[model samples]
Target: MSSFQNLKKSRDARRGKPRPNTSSTSGTSGPGVTNAGDGTYGMDDELASKAREVLSTALGIPLGQDEPGLEFLDDPEVEITNVSSYDSHGRKQNVSPGIDNLRSKDQVTGKGKGKVKQPQVSNEHVRKRGKDEVSHELYKSELEGSGIEVHTLPGKGRGLITKRLIKAGTIILKTPPSISALQNQHFQRVCHGCYLTMKERNIASCKNEKERYEKKMRGELKIKLNRCSGCKVLHYCSRECQLSDWPTHKHECIALQRFRKMYYKTYPTKKQDDDDLSWTQASPEPVRALARIIWKRRVEREKNGGKDGIWWKQIASLESHVSKSTQQEVMRLAQQAQHLQHYLSASIPLKGSDVDVGEDQLLPVNMEDFGFEDVQEVMNFCSSFHVNSFTLSSPSLTPIGVSNSPLMALSNHSCDPNAIVVFPNGAKYMELIAIKDIQSDEEILTSYIDLSCPYDIRQRDLKERYRFQCDCKLCEKSKNQGVDWVDPRWCVRHEGCKGGDGKGKMPVKGSKGVVSVKCDKCQEDFKVNAEEVLSVVQKGVDVLDSDEHRQLDYKTAQKALSTLIPNLQKHLPNHSYPLLSLLRLSSVSHTPPQSPKDLQIASKHIKQAYEACYEVYHQNHATPTLILCEYAKLLSLQDSEQTKMVDLSRNIAMKNTIIRNLLEAIEMLTKAVKQSEITFGKGFVVGKELEGILEGCKEEMERLKRS
Candidate 1:
């Protein structure tokens, strides 16, 4: 027997009904039912008539003919009884006993004598259609004035192209998400409505003066989040935000509540670690996003007669890459689809059980229609997210959630992109801004992955995650002229060859056995054991990639640098990517710097890293700008006590050195501010923060000069 059959049998047995036998062909069965040699079961005429009467009364509908068997009760799970109804004032009403109260008086009595009144159809369709039309118009208006339009490209399918000249820092497009969800790790720390972090909550609700003063000094406010009382999972900054999110949150809340109850019943002794313990592990961010999409479609179907709106049409048209998926990937998608089916089936309330008449009540629509047709459909949605979803980040470029907007996904990928997508002011809407000047009819491109890595790593990541090889201008240049000609990250300098510039270096090349590098100017060749250089570079890469090394103590940082710097300098240039990454790691690993000597050492490393970053990344790129900011901040760490000592000793040399350092720090900060304006935009939070730091550096410079 199938799982549904087993479930039905258990439910019938619990209700004190005799279990029907499949093999007994000659005997009379339970409840006036009999089985013949044929596949169909037979029921007595009198019993069949009575069953029809009961069913018609319970369903609030008249039955035309009697069925042959009890096949209607094959799935015996009772649906929740409460049904969603509407009042005259346009408010939801939960009516119990299966929508019987919705019928006219004459119809309920089975009397066709009086004129039967037809049920009133809701105007929700008209209202919803109008709203959708208005939203579509708004999107079109935004696109029309934004100087970009969707166009067909040769091989990239749909792409956004500039209609006119677009300067750097110009906002190209601002679009709201079709759907978005916070990751599991950010459920509590980030607001579900505005996507604000705990430290950036702007509503002031401090109870004491001291707390208020501290918050004011930090340019923040102490606001308590309002958590949903039902699921207790999502948190909002205010009641207004909660209300604004209710349309989507209501379904999530109900599903999460049912999921938790079912989970605890299955594992009765399982201890809850946190409030989101149950659903967080079972339904991650992607699963939750898929669930919301399903629920939204269901709502759209019921409210608008299954009309294909802009959001649904775009979502359905996204590329799933199902045909190109690997066997392991298909298996993973299938497993996720199964989990989604289990979650929805177990959580969504049935159509006629006596549950509490709250917002959790099911609509009178068919409960069997759960948006998706089968596992294949759900699997398609799961795969679509892998390609179409964007990592939603804060204004400061910190990732906070995942979002999908079909409009934004139209832009193609390029390592050397002219545009960038960002969420300005922590809002949910995405804004595409030009990072470089673009002429009319130019295709707008954005980087889907980090551009800080070398060519091989970027290619590998793009192929593995996005399932496509990059053929951008940068990639083409690197392939045509060699990686060393375009990329500075993987170059190594020769010790004895004195040709070209003094810093002339060539790309590291060769197999695992022997590594060789030839000078680009003098054609001088040097060979080394690949194991020595490659193994050390691999170690540095591992250290940089490890999560444990995100923060390291001064001792650990010193040890790592002591071992890596000498070995790397012998075979690689100071501006090599791996060397620069280690220096950056060592500089930040000191945290606040234990002593003045430690501070000076950290500053020196950061300055070196900044130089390497400037050489590697573009002048107007975010990576170099951020590195410059760090270098300036490190140099400005001289304490008041150090200045006082210099004054007391009248050390002319030390005073001059400090003054020069301050001047250099100010110049770096100024350059960083200018670069941030192009990379992060002028009005962005990062640019404003850089400006604030620049002002502080200027004040410090003047103070040192006066002293």
Candidate 2:
């Protein structure tokens, strides 16, 4: 998941690795600087989270200039981001940094250069696309029930599939982002926060003739009406859209209106609150971590004399433009706080169960009021109790106060999700896409990320990181074995073993299901069918260390690995542990290791492992990438006599492309990793293999180009 990759990137940043280019993203700046491990791109995962935090502040929330996270002139993700802080595009009134080649070195563009050319990359593609905002149509249509589907799903709750296949950039849903209306203001166009008029919400063209005509007169942008007495932040295009939206919102709007200024209230009646706790584990970790980041951002802003507010995103302004020195001061403080969060996440002692929330901690109030009057309450809220105010209205855009609600909180986390939620700009609107064809009544699952780690490692991280014992079917069945396996764990088990269908639906104890049949490991009266057992897979993972495997024979294990891995792969997800074992076996295919056939086999296995690993995991998954590097070394063999070839020229020609592609994959993974680092503090960085490969490739590219 991109979110996890973001977490990984944040961790990497903390580890002192350079951050990725923030300019490539929309408006926000990332917060966490953790690293991640994955299979695809080499550099992306380690820095995505910090990148997200940057963007969040950039576009999502209504923030004060003095808030902590802002005030830096340089994009945090870039190593050579020497330009006065911020992406070069929005420098006020000054001649922008026009250097294009800077982006080739992973630097944000300085704004005015023609382009940068080197061995690996020549230039960077910046976002000419506007920030993530609602198109007039999506906003208008959503209220009128445009593309929403509320159909009944089988095992999963109601499946919310798209009415049509939407384009990547198209706005799927939009509601008002966080609104900041003064107590006395009646009606005025301003930024929802600082009140930037240009940052409009969901203003799009009307497609239907009737809707178009109505909007032109008084539908969308031209509607004239009574100014909102409370937060006058809302402007309806027509009475129709307002009227259309009112049905879904009058219940909450009226409640908000009564409070006047910013307010947070608990459900007066217990009946009003429904018990939705799916994310008690995963949700709290990320949310609490984010809240802390928001505070650091706030504090940093204050030190630099820049009032800053936190939002959920990938990039943001890091310093004061007028006083560059002050920007450094702000960044220093925010960076310190960020580091502390990272360390604490890594070092803290964890308990086994969920932390209960006290009643006093559930209420919503102005952050200032909460901090000043009820410090303990604030602490409790930070620890484990509060509303989800940061949830996205659409997968991409967030509507303040609306995002944190419980209705959107019921979904659970999975390493390999059954559903995909895409919020393009990472602030407001979103579309939950079903990646594969789902069954009529299957539980709609969306993987939080690829479940490529060994079973133990996976469970440990989920429990400590996300805070939940994943009870998903896949996790449950895989629990007994060290990995998530279908019924036929061994390609073909020993003679007497008969795997039964893992699901309980099998009437006969011995009966098993196709995908997950159990082995014939029979007990006194009961036969543990691999098929039936397979249906009950475990979602959480358990971490495994060297001590546990010390007893295995390396030589014999190698032989077994070769035999079991490929067949095992046929029965499970691509990035499974068994497949990795095969790669290890293949890695040492030769005696002296100088033979051609040996290198060929090693390269083939390594490449195969990476391909499978990447297919099943995050793009920047480290294990496979590491294997790929080992493979690359073999592929780049040179005896000095006759460069006995194996697509040597092709590999050389496509050298940059391969590493560039790897870097691209890593960047995506970095986004997800950054999120994990912020919330879980797992010290994942760009996979070791990614780092090794890219550096090696860069050198190789330069060598090839020079020659």
Candidate 3:
């Protein structure tokens, strides 16, 4: 039975109905009716009517008419997996068919119902459409003398070099993406055109038509998405965005619909033993990404006379690392290409009545008819994606999309990079900003991995994925000068030395694979194995990284994190995982203090976290900004206690410290805000929050004077 039918059975059982035979041959049955031949219960007319009513109400489709060929009488089944509805425009709409049906009568505002007209794309076009070309154009016209030049480095093939000295926090590159794809998992939740999260909770709501009209008059109501009335696959946040994106989305619309149909037809009906259905894990993100590239390439060709259309020549110059990729890697990409080719072949129509009925319908080429050279193009695109794609992530570092940009990809990797890439407002554009001053002709660089990771971990990651041994200055220094006390152990030397006294000691030379580490500073031989501490660290990581940990309530998660803090303190660097995790958990618990004593303890940990992160990341990084933000919050809580203090001398001293801390935090936050603007655009999400922190700081200063 279909999952929907199973759901119907479950609902009937919940309603205290007996299990229906579901296979009775009788033309009709009534409530409490039984088949005399087998003495088995069946849903009789009364129950059948109720069931149909429930299915229609819940599944949004009338019984026997859900799918085109589903026989309602043959079995008690209602396949609602791919249901759709039509809008007033005569275009098929996706789910959430009748918004009025879902909303209460009071919320059925008649405002903003005017039809949105899509605009035409303005560009030069070829007489014959859809021709591919190769060109030697390497960069955009604007980038000709933008203080940065693409240069061939010694070991690194191509990298961005400075044409002139650029100051710290300068906007080095502000380039839009060549092509970006929203993760398939986010198809329904985010607008396909503008990348805005479309969750009902996130969207604005008006109480009634009057309020909506008032908001419109006040110019407060924002433009919202209209579920596309064509293929019913995507939502556009605005008509402008829809019109701008139609060129690319048009090609994939029918193919996406057909793919969905084919996919659901073959989907399993039976429940599996392990039914883990996380969209991120199961989604075809790479496939969708490749599909966008293919369609956009075709569209660009049609519009630009096949002269390396849509500035694709810049991407063509990117290194695919074909010679560097192993056989296993090549095979994996080939398999993915084959899967997509098969899907496209099935999606494209070949005969009468099979043709897609919509704007810009599919052309007359079968993907299955693609030959070796055609498939090779896909393979080469995959190779380029493997080497050059940058993750488009939120401020908190959660990935939302995958994109490749020619300008952004030019910056090479560095462990201690002078520049950083930031995604603003969830858009696919990458902003490359200088975190430190760059001298003339100096190469622009950014870290591909987190810089706070221990040296060994960072190096391994770089080698495996980037296919290069990082000889960046930081890595080189660590290699030549011996490892820093990133991983610590209690010193046994001078029995009362306090185990390096929180200033962890470096391991002695030739200490690799040693059972015991001798502190290079104190010459103390400690009975600690690096491997054992690593094992414990991995254990803590496993717990924190588990799905169960994420689902835990705040109090429960705090308790779980508390147990790991001591182990982390004894072993890991203050700027490493242990303290970073502690700081993250503590930041979440930012309620006003219950007492002065409670506030004091929280302040101590907050200070330690700030100092630790500052030491490792320095002033120009995001971590310091985060830590300083928390510091300002802690000061706010402590500042409130000053009004209650009766001791004159203590009050004066406390006031001075509060002002001092507030000033210092303001300074750090200001730098962070500046860096944030450079990294992301001024409109970034985190920058708004930082601005809020700055406002809070200013308010606290005023409150302090009043007290």
Candidate 4:
């Protein structure tokens, strides 16, 4: 037989559609009817009964004798050959019991039309089938010379532990993402290949009207992105980047183009403006990541002769949390699966072979090749992505996309983590660096969420997103001792307290609608309505978060800060989280200070904000380092000329102060460089930038001394 004929025969056998009963009368010739005279009538009836029983068992729904949907089982077009069965170990297995349909003719046949002999299974391969063994081998291979090993912990399933002492600033592991994609919002601003944001490439639009005008006045060229010609959604920084990403982006490009066409066709009245691609942004990052994964698996399966490659196996090993998913999570995943199905259907080949896609426009993947029995498989993929994905970040630690690296997910979460994941080079590569010196046999842990948030907020976010309550040392310490040192949300100052020079903290606790407080030193009790304090603080936060306040001018920003800061201070602590937020806002809102007074005020606010940040986020953290860099820059801006004092004594004092400020700025910049090295990684862009600022500060100090 010809290859095409063989292919058709294989496809037919896989579908398992029964031949029609031609001998039966026309009235009884429909599906589920077998001619009484036919010798196979009883066998056909038994097969139908078994299929119905398996379907009911798999679906967990009883199929009564008079079930209305019974006719579809006998329909020739409906394929019902494969059914799920449990093995002796109670694990679900797919039982096909025939030649695999995906096999090529060469793979299926040997010389003289004989079947190809299968290879013997080895004990190693059998051992790899166990989850724990697979994880151990995968980590062993991935971290061969990195001095780390995967060990099963008592409570934690599997953790990366140090085989040798790992010093701080050491690169523990570096792995490229198996799959990564930009969020829909970053599609235009970030490169699809290198994941470099437009701003990082110095091609982004001006930040504000003033900056745009300044650039225009200077006759600077306005840079634009090179968008993918097929999709018009993904942007590239250069032709080289576009070409480099073609292997992965080609499938996505075709899918996006089809999605665009389908979208406009579905909503005829909805018009897309020239610069607006919001219609194309309907699918989120996870959907795009899942598409990439499916396409990759298809390509790999073909290359590996009908077997999934190592990449797919690595991703599949990660926990999906499907069995533990709540009803709401299941519903959400179901909706996402529906969206994925719609997207895949739009990009797949049509029913007939007569309509073939051109060489320039290939379909993303053949849906039949995916082997997804139902939408449940897609939901499982989505769940795995939600649980195992990481925030793809720039070298400066700004989030740009979502990525999945199975090797990196081995480390568990801890509030006081010893190791940290960073993309010090770029989003294409990730590095796990030790933030603290980890001794041998110490389990490597990394924070899955931001640590700067208060204790309650941190716990709530972790529970809602990751479905676990953190029992890290920091959490336990907060629970056993007091949260005041870690969370300052409820700490207030008592004016008339008899401890610490009449200045002591009044710990506030609230329940229901009332708040009670007692001074630590004075033992005085006070009561305040929760609504009166919390409501006001929440309103202030909302105002700061609003767009109107976000773009205020220096004068308007100062006025807003003046009004909000004092009110919040009256009801909250001097260094409360809300007050820290307001202080940081004050520093940024009045950038490029208009006058000496404005400069002084901005400097003061930033200094206060830095102090608060230092207390909240310890010295070696990224937050404090970032704030210290800004504070150093502000200090460098304060000079003798900016202080315009008339009196000679005051002028001399101001000059001395300027000298002191410059010296202090130099010292802070030097410290910031070191901190940046630890947090952002040695030789990272942020560390280099801090070093440059420190050098400039040293130059300024030398000029001051020479004068």
TM-score of each: 0.68, 0.30, 0.64, 0.68
lDDT of each candidate versus the true structure: 0.51, 0.28, 0.45, 0.50
List clashing residue pairs in candidate 4.
Answer: none
Where does model 4 exceed 4 Å of error? 1-132, 198-225, 262-274, 349-368, 371-373, 482-490, 496-531, 540-562, 581-603, 634-661, 700-707
**Candidate 4 CA-lDDT value:** 0.50
The digit string of per-residue lDDT tens for model 2 on 529-560 reads 45533332221010011101112333443454
Q: Is candidate 2 or candidate 3 better by lDDT?
A: 3
lDDT of 3 by residue, 285-360 (tens): 5455556666666556656664445366665655554556677556555555544553343334434343333211
lDDT of 3 at 690: 57
lDDT of 2 at 105: 11
Looking at candidate 4, the ten consecutive residues that score lowest on lDDT are 23-32
Candidate 3 yields a Cα-based lDDT of 0.45
**For model 2, where is the 10-residue window of minimal lDDT?**
92-101
Q: Model 1, which residues run further than 4 Å from truth?
A: 1-141, 201-220, 224-226, 257-279, 345-370, 482-486, 496-515, 548-562, 574-605, 636-662, 699-707
- Residue 322 of candidate 3: its Cα lDDT? 51
Better of 3 and 4 by TM-score: 4
> Is 1 or 2 the stronger prediction by lDDT?
1
| Each model's backbone clash number | 9, 209, 4, 0
Cα RMSD of predicted structure 4:
20.0
Tens-place lDDT digits, model 1, residues 62-147: 12211111111111212111001111110111010011111100000000001111111123422222222332343474576676
